[model samples]
Target: MFDKLTRTFSDVLRQVSGKSSISEKNIQDAVEEIKIALLEADVNLRVVRRFVNHTIEEARGEKVLRSVNPGQQFIKIVHDRMVNLLGSETEGLQLKGPDTLSPILFMGLQGSGKTTTCAKLALRLKKEGRKPLLVAADLVRPAAVKQLQLLGEQTGVPVFAVEGEKKPVKVVKQALSFAKKNSFNTMIVDTSGRMHLDDDLMKEIQEINSVLKPVEGLLVADAMTGQQAVEIAKEFNERVGITGVILSKFDSDTRGGAALSLKSVTKKPIKYVGVGEKIDELEQFHPDRMASRILGMGDVVSLVEKAQETIQEEEAEELQKKLQSSTFTLQDYLEQFTRIKKMGSLQSLVEMIPGMKGNIDEDALNSKEMKKEEAIILSMTLQERHNHRIIGPSRRKRIASGSGTSVFDVNRLLKKFDKMRLMMKKMTKNKKLQAQMLSQFNGNI
Candidate 1:
């Protein structure tokens, strides 16, 4: 989501690359641009200064001078430094005591997507083969418990909630008891939030922490808040000693400032980032891949993980068989749309591919365009979705009426789907060609 930062770094690197030999003056000019970019993105001024200084010092080191491409060498130095700033190595969630049960607490401000993230984490833990219990300790708001319950239902996880309970500490203690009784291996406490930081709120969370002895206290901060987010994280860490940070809304137009500065400022690693609103959008924070994305390089590992999580194995296998037989159909088209829907917003998905952020129209990605297309497809009959040969003028009119869309809209969808299907067939014929095109597509992103 650091589109501006990526563009700035790319331009700076290009300028450095044009030089046969690097000089202090040239490096300073590039660093100046980077500094401005970081400041404009609302990065902490002190952190920006330190980062720029480190980059300059590294550029002047022997490694850059003896390198084949001094510009690329400088880029590597900057990337490595950025990774160090964002926490060089990943730190996974810690679970204490027996493997049969452990407590993990999530705390953050209101509207930080804490409940949704709690469900996401439960789904993740479930996939990892851990039996996690969802505890709704957010009694400050009436809907909090209901929201967690709905999420639990959607994820097929049990929600431990005490109706009308006003005390968070008591709610959590009871929830932990429920977890122990049910044999749930882990307890996740989704705590309440306040409009702003306060003593009572902190005291409540602290009391819950004291009772639960949580192995991990996760601060789910919204990434779109910029440098202020880092300050909030620091406050929480100072008050309650957060085990790690979780940056929600990473798919939004968040500058990488908070992510890059938080670890350095708070001395805590960002364990995970919420890339999308979907349950599968949660991903382990990888410093190296994040640095690569900020430098206009794609993150293939994250992309592959997203693909694996979103695309059903059985469906992929069937699609591969169809590709081998050159028998792709409109049904496959609908399936592709379904898969993308499960993966969350297309724009967000593209932005995670390293350099694709700024160049995309984010509004379009978050809009109802995909849903409208799906509706049009849903209006079609089974034969129509599969064969696409039986839709005559009358049928088209009926389908449009059923979908509440115009006949022109239906025609446009059919045309687009046909084109995509044709392109898929062409790509399937040549694996190397397809790989090359996909690589280029990733690079541009």
Candidate 2:
């Protein structure tokens, strides 16, 4: 996500890092580079101009040019402006919480993933111990109701849809009554949309809004749509009054113009972003964290939060023990891969590591190489997994045949495992290096 923009910023900052002192020409050159990067990312032209002007004015200030570390100071100025451009701070759903109606109305153009985003929001609320009801108010689109209901069942969230009621307002009324009777604290209404903005679609959404009186009117915009998304958001806010935005299909948006342009254009914060197709892949948008990620600083906080969700305490302790004892094996390696897969794509994880963004090819991570590695381990015997040393040439050939791979593949796996073991042993035995690593891990660096 935002890989191209991140790389551009990285290149400009890398140049600044080599500067002996900040000069007028230095700031001018850097700002020019930034302008080109933003324009290439498809950011709103007005927003990019304002950004360049603001950055240039600040970078030229005495406080920045005379700073002990001028490069770091200039970076801070740009980060602050980007944060402001992205929304000065994180904003959440304006729900009262408890026995209230708590209607969260979702609206967007057709094919914006609004239905799935509605289900994702319901799942999130359900996980937070709130009883959420999914209201399928998208009566215009054929099978939209059925789609929402299927997603609701899959996510273990209840759905309310009145059969044969073509009127979305009527369906929502029934859903509200259902929620009230069932004591549901949250209600998410999936509204109808058209291929493009139209009077009929806007009127239907406005009527739905009037009936639901939602606590949050969220527009589900596709980040891939670029500036058109910003325009959609503005029109929605003007016509139906959206409270926030949910950037759907954001994980696939490499340029990231919509995410950076939406807030500035609509004056609405992006409350959530759809990171993947899964129901659990929705993430709350954080301005500071996104700013850090955009600047190649990585989002360690989000990485740790993701790990907390996927890794258990005892499992981590057991992995630590294995590392310390130098007892890691093929089984452990396979298990590690499975865990990382659960968290997200390997490329996304790599992007979250500081200085490694845009350096990994996502296709490479998803290629036959990963599958072959897993297959080779699965073909190995239990004893072979515990002690790979017993696997000779004949055993390697058998394992390769069993795994539908070549003998060379087996050899490659063994060599990689040997390198990993050596690295673990080297790190565990070096006390000073271990201390330095601990300090860095603890953010002392």
Candidate 3:
């Protein structure tokens, strides 16, 4: 989501990448550009200073200046330093064994998406084969408990809330007993939040934390808050200890100041990030992969992981066979759309592919166009989907009317599908051509 920062780094790299030699002045100029970019992106002033200083010190070293490929060496130094500034390594949640009860207390300010993050984490743990119970201990906010209950139902995770309980500590205690009795291995307590950090709010959270003795006290900070989120996290960590941080609304946070600055300022890792509103949109943070993304290097590992999670092995094999046989139909095309939608938005997917960042029009990949194409495909009869060649002029007009599109639109889609199928047939039959294309793709990556 660091679009501006990515562009800046990409521009600096392109300017210096092909040079046979680079001087100290060149290194300083590049680092200066990076410093301005980070500051404009709202990164912490101290963090930006440290990152710039470290990068310069490393890039100006004799080992880098005299390397066989000095320009590439300089780029590597920048990438490595950025990775280190981001955290150096991925840190996962420290949880007890599945046999033991693991209480995870969520604390944040109001409107930070803390309640939703509770449900999202529970769903993730549930998918990971943990029996998670959502405790609606947020008695302050109106409808907070009901909101958690609704989220629990959507996620298929049970919720524990005492109807008349006013004290969050009492509710949490009862929730622990209920979880133990019900064999719930993971307990996620949604604690009350305030408009701002107040004494009463801190006291309530502290009491609940003491009662729960949680294995993880995660602070759900809003990424959109930028450095303010970092300040809030630092305060939370100081007042009531937090094991890690969770940046919510990360997908919408294009500047990415909070994510880049939180770990550095708080000395706590970002265990997870809230990418979207869906229960399944939570993603574990990987510092190396994130650094790659920020530098416009792409995150192929995360892309592959998302594919593995969304696409079934059997279905993928069947699609491959159909492509090889030249039997891929409109039905298969529509199914592919559904699978990609499940994986994520098309723009997000494009950003994950190696060498594809900032290369496509964002508006062209918006959901409206995809929905229109899906409508056109769904308006077709089952036989028409299986045998698109059978749709003549009359059928085309009817399909267009049914889909609320023009006949030209239908024809254009058919033309594109035919060309794609022909390309697949050619690639399947010609191993030499396929290898050449594969080599080209690998070169770009």
Candidate 4:
């Protein structure tokens, strides 16, 4: 998401990494480039200054200056300092035991995606084996309660809301009793928000907070708002006392100003980030991995985690068996496409691979090309999928017509599939190549 920052850091690294040794002047030059990049990205001026100063102080130390690889040493210093600026480690929600009613109060300005985040968090907690109830306590906005209700339906989490309750505190109080009676371990209350922070808004939130005695008063801020998100978090932390922050629309936050500045300004950890509009697109924030991604070093840990979450172990083992036996078919190939799509956008996944950042065509990876491939594969008959070689010219034209593509497109896909199959067959027979591939895969994990 930090595309600009990543490109700048990559450029700076390229200038320094190839050197046999680096001088203080070289470090200052690279740091200055970074400072400008951060500023352009809308990062806080104070944060940029502090980050720049700390990086220079560390880079000028004898340890980096006299190191065998000064360039690499300097890069490590930057990565470490960036991680600290982003919060040194991941911080999770502090919850009581499942037997207790752990209320999580959500607060934010209108249009910050606070209601949707409540559902997302509830779904996540449900997946983690907690009985979560989504409380639609956002009474100020006309459709907020309905929105939360619809979201709860989509997520399969129950929503607790009085039919006509106007006071958020009363709604939350009733929700607590309902949750405890129903054995719900976690209650996520979507409190009211406003266009701007007003005393009435703060008072309503504070009253609800006092009633719920929430374990986590999370402020959901729009990452696209840049520095304004940090200011909003500070205000909420001061008035309503937020325990953590959740940055919504983070996937679209290409500049990454809010995420880079939030922790430094508010001292509140970003517990979760809404990566996409889908209910399942929320991700836990990892500072070290984010730092790596920002430096164009990739985030293999997050990539592997996405794989583990979306791909079933049995399915992976079955695919391995098919590959070893040279029995992989177009059906298996299509299934693999579906699995990868579930993991995330191809561009995002590619960014997680080391050295692959900014090296992909966004249109090609995310647009009609992939959809066309899937359509062509789906147009194939079961027998054609199992035995692609059996498709003659007539069948090719028929499949292309069914898929709304030209015969040339179908042929291209078949050729690509054939090449892939041949490679897999070769790898199956080559024990040494297979071992090397397995070793690399395991090492990434």
Which candidate ranks first by TM-score, i.e. highest?
3
Q: Give per-model TM-scores.
A: 0.86, 0.95, 0.97, 0.96
Q: What Cα-based lDDT does every candidate model obtain? A: 0.83, 0.88, 0.89, 0.89
Model 2's lDDT to the true fold? 0.88
lDDT of 2 by residue, 276-342 (tens): 9988889999998898789776777888888988899999888877887889888898898788878
Give the runs in model 4 whose Cα sits over 4 Å from its true position.
Answer: 426-445
Instruction: Please identify model 1 stretches exceeding 4 Å from their true place.
Output: 17-20, 96-98, 163-167, 278-280, 312-314, 354-376, 389-419, 438-445
Please give, for residues 1-445, the per-residue lDDT of candidate 1 as tens digits: 7878888877876678656678777778888998898888788888888999998888888787777778767777878888888889978998754456889999999988899999999999888889999998898865989999999999998999886677888888788778888888889999989989999989999998899998899999999888888999999999999989999999787677788789889999999999887776798888888887787776767777778977878878889778657567666766788777676667646756655666666776754777778888788888887778678899989989998899999898878877776777777777899889787765443
* Native-to-model Cα distance after best TM-score fit, residue 354 in candidate 4, in Å: 0.5
Which portions of model 2 show Cα errors greater than 4 Å?
A: 359-367, 428-431, 434-445
- After TM-score superposition, what is the CA distance of residue 254 in candidate 3 from its true location, in Å? 3.1
lDDT of 3 by residue, 151-172 (tens): 9899999999998888889999
**Candidate 2 vs. true structure, TM-score:** 0.95
Q: Is 2 or 4 the stronger prediction by TM-score?
A: 4
Cα RMSD for predicted model 2: 2.0
Model 4 CA lDDT for position 223:
92
Q: For model 3, what is the error of residue 318's alpha carbon versus the real structure, in angstroms, after optimal superposition?
A: 1.7
Error of 1 at 278 (Å): 4.4
Residue 163 error for model 4, in Å?
1.3
